[model samples]
Target: MTGTGQALWRRVPLWGVDASLVALSLLDAWINLYGEASPFMWASAALGCAGLFLRRRLPLAAFLLTLPMLVFMDVAVAPMVALYTVAAHTRNRLLLAGCALLNAAASTLVWPMSDTLSGEDRTWTLIQFVYTLATAFAPVLFGQLVQARQDVARQLVEVEEAREHESALYAQTVLARERAQLAREMHDVVSHQVSLIAVQAGALQVAAKDPQTRDGARAIRTLSVNTLDELRHMVTLLRASGGRATELTPQPTLAELQQLIANSGIETTLAGELPPGISTTAQRTIYRTVQEALTNVRKHAPGARAEVRLWHDTQHFGVTITNTAPTRPSVPLPSAHHGLIGLRERAELLDGTLTAEPTRQGGFTIELRAPTHPS
Candidate 1:
């Protein structure tokens, strides 16, 4: 439905209740009482009850309009309900107290004990007076309670919305960081391979004698130039913005670890199988951890024997890479390299732990332990 239709639907029940109250007041003053009903008094009560229809939107007007009925009828419902509407909307304590006092005074005067009060009449009149005060005050207090409850519920909804918003922002920031890390890894791997190609191309251009061989060398150089241009473009795209896809191969998992070690040509022992139901995300983390550890070992400890161990129990999966001190040490890579830091962050995202430390045996060890299943 349209906005106006929805609003009208909400108001229909309120108006129906108001109409019911008016009808009930008329019937009570006329047909349902033990005393003889006066036509004037019954009409006054019905008119006052009509004010309930406007109480939600025009509370003060409804209260003032219905006040006369309280002065003329000994027991009434409409004025108390009208006073409740005003109290629910207004925050002024003095105004609420004054309205309650006025209704109580008018209600007490409507009784007949003011004339010729015997001892029994006086006692009954005092009890009636206390009852009148309770009637006048209870509705306003109840209205205030309703207002407080609604306020607390609204605040809870706002807090939940705020928490969700903060969570989204944190996820976006983590995604951006991961993208930058991937771009850096691609740059390092591609540049290393491209440098070797450039060196081979130069040797061909210098040594080739036949026309066909020279032409092939020139083509190889051109292809390398084009490849470098594309690499630069890919890196730019990866960093300039986020939440975009790139046509990259799927990440390696445990299946590729053997090829990784064989290609490294390092004498390393590999043991342990991945447990069932390990998440794809955790698999990628394990792959990257091993990759970074192997790269570090190759760079810093060229010919040292290394050991790779994998283990898992019902609750956890782990990887450990250890290498003896370098038989031949070389200058290390730049400190700004992100491999170890990315692995640490990757493990943390999975609620896992990664540790790289030197053992007392004069060797470095990298250990990673993560849950076997996603939480």
Candidate 2:
């Protein structure tokens, strides 16, 4: 269809009609360049020019007027341009019907004057009369067909675009449902186990004799409890059904670092205003990291004061937990646990990094760098 439009517009025949009309108009003036009735020839030429100007706007008026104007001046010129405009722009069928009759009468009047007539001249003039009627309507017919084709093409394009948009929306809906389902399963499995670990560890801490043993158990208890709550909130969020309001649920933030440190029995200090709505994954990782660092502090350097610094820079939300080395030399550190491995895994999931090494001030520092979503 698009190819058809290009071909139709580019064809020489379609353009030739208008070009021939203009040429005939100019030829009329030249043939009567110097004549006995030069005044009437010039007047007819002026009318032809005026008809051309009004062809697109007042088409019916121009076409009707051209017939009388040409006949009165004794001119025999074709008005193919104005006739085509009349067919295309005007809606008055009677006017076109009257114009057709007047045109046939005018053509017959000039038919006797031309010397090109033979025995077939009457038949030729009749055929030409019918041809003139059809040719006058060619522009209107072609213009209508073009408009209809363009309308159909536009509709098809709109339908294709609408289908693509619907497919993309469906895919996003499927992905969101899958993510919510995974969040539910994670909550169900981890929450119960963490809660039990925290309760039992807290109970064990009460009966421990030495301060180091007590502090280690207490650290485990706090981490377990926080992990449990976080998991529970995640499950609640997934279990919700219908409407946007159901999506809300409890979660943790960096502000809870103090309570996390207290339960670890580490002398912790915090500085800077904490950001809000710290993601669940980020908070969970930070809590576990702090728990591990403080437990290591208590087990290896029992009397060493622990410092927990949590602050948000322009780019990263950081957690730096450092503790003094054991006053007595050669104290053995606690055995490595799954907590550090899990913390590393969690950080990697969020495209963050975690490092545990000795700080410049002679203490072990657990540094966590998290890419936070800005509030």
Candidate 3:
């Protein structure tokens, strides 16, 4: 049924209850053999029972209006039910107590005269009060108990909700700690090895007799230096406050940077297609190498011609980025020069290698090789 229809249906029982109260008023008087007093007793009974229709909307008013009528009316139960409604709905203890006292007082003053009163003429009305007053105020006591139980139930629900929220916050703290630990391990283990490679490569370039071998050593040294710079910056991010919060944003992919490189004014000569199922580690390493290479060219060799080559054979997939020396080396820019070092560490993690160095003609080159199927 619709809400309005359901509400009307619920009131149907209340209408019957109200009719019963009015009929009960007549029976209480007639059963007590209150002799033919005029229609005045009937009028009072009708008015007393009728007040119940407004008890929920105007409970205190309904009780006040009906209580006094019991002084003359034969209302057997309406005033007590109205008093219970007031007690349950009232939020203020002071107000509820006052209303309960008022109900007891009205009963003391009025019940002696009403046929709803079981108490008739007795020598000790005050002693009889101890017995009669209990019945009059019992509804208020029951309603207050009901209210107390409901309050406790609501408090339990609030406590449960608070505990769940605290548990979620604890879970987040543990996850951030794990990410920071991984960053620390990279710095302690892989960073040391890459640094050693850079130093050896620098030594080899100076000692080499052949032109091609010397050039390859120079390239490896350059790549190592850049990788160190990148690794340091990445570690800093992981250790910073709310570092994990930033990871939710997507990282760049090597396969998806056509526009990104083009917009940066690098004439990318991308060759073979990246293999279909390259791992996430490979993708990130390639993207970082290209990104760092372009950045280095922009800083040290402004307006340098650049080329990118991608190819993969049975055992390996590779990318090479080479750029001519800048036309204006005089243009000043700050360089931590560690991006390639970070990329090498990434490659090492995937059981791969990356090399970077300057060409004999004063151009820079970076090459990365990742396994087709990582162990």
Best TM-score goes to which candidate?
1
* Candidate 1 wrong stretches, greater than 4 Å: 1-12, 29-43, 110-131, 195-211, 240-375
lDDT by residue (tens digit), candidate 1, 1-375? 999998887878766877887677555445533375567666667667777778888988888767766666654667777888888888778998888877776676643545526665666656776787788889889878877776557545544544553354355456767878877977889966876786788689889998888888878877887887788778754543222133144656687888888886578889877687676567767877887788677656656778889889888898999998775434433333355666777787678999988988777999999876657
Ranking by TM-score: 1, 3, 2
The lDDT for every candidate, in the order shown, is: 0.72, 0.62, 0.68
Evaluate model 3: give its TM-score.
Answer: 0.46
The CA-based lDDT of model 1 is what? 0.72
TM-score comparison, 2 vs 3, better candidate:
3
Candidates 1 and 2 compared: the better one by TM-score is 1
Give the count of colliding residue pairs in each prediction.
0, 0, 15
Deviation in angstroms for 175 in model 1?
A: 2.5
For residues 1-375, write the lDDT of model 3, one tens digit per residue.
Answer: 999998887878776866776567557645543675457655665566677777768878777766655555434476777777787777677877777666555655544355434456443545545555676568888777877776556545434543453344355456557767988898998799999999999999999999999999999999999999999878765653232244546666774766557876655566567778886556766776787677666556655788878778998997898998765323343333345545665677678898888999899899998788878
Candidate 2 lDDT for residue 203: 85
Question: Where is model 2 more than 4 Å wrong at Cα?
Answer: 1-135, 195-210, 224-375
